[model samples]
Target: MTGIRIELSRRERAILRAVAAGRGVLVSSCEPALTIDGCWCDHAAVHNLVEAGLIEKERQVPYGLATPAVITRAGEAALAEDPRST
Candidate 1:
């Protein structure tokens, strides 16, 4: 088996930074508390993170529809390694 190489894009890094600052967890697609030049994270970026096993999404029915996400251990490690993520 091979290992996955984590390369974070500028957008992805922004998302991770937001999550990390929120104590490593927050609602997916929620308005970012942190943004770069007022640019918040998008759905595609969240989906990409989920697919990469860097974030975990759980089903929730808050106000009838929503799913929250939390950063995974791998995600924390990734952020630690990627200086841009901080």
Candidate 2:
């Protein structure tokens, strides 16, 4: 990986960690929902991660449905680069 690094808030970092651990999902709804093991997570943080292209749905799903979230290459890079991850 390159030396490029991305800054992330604590919540965003937690969400990324959860997704990397296979415990996160994105539910498509009137307001998209992010969940970890069926528990709610901060919407703003989830949205921010998605918008930043660090995480994405694992597969396509219809509206009002849920799909597993997967960390993107950028996400992996971010996790690897984050000092807090150590």
Give the TM-scores of the predictions, in the order they appear.
0.61, 0.88
The model with the greatest lDDT is: 2
Q: Clashes per prediction?
A: 0, 0
The candidate scoring highest on TM-score is 2
Colliding pairs, model 2:
none
* lDDT of prediction 1: 0.60
Off by over 4 Å in 2: 1-4
C-alpha lDDT (0 to 100) for residue 42 of candidate 1: 71
lDDT of 1 by residue, 5-52 (tens): 599888887777666554333343443222223444576776677778
Predictions in order: lDDT: 0.60, 0.87
Candidate 1 collision pairs: none
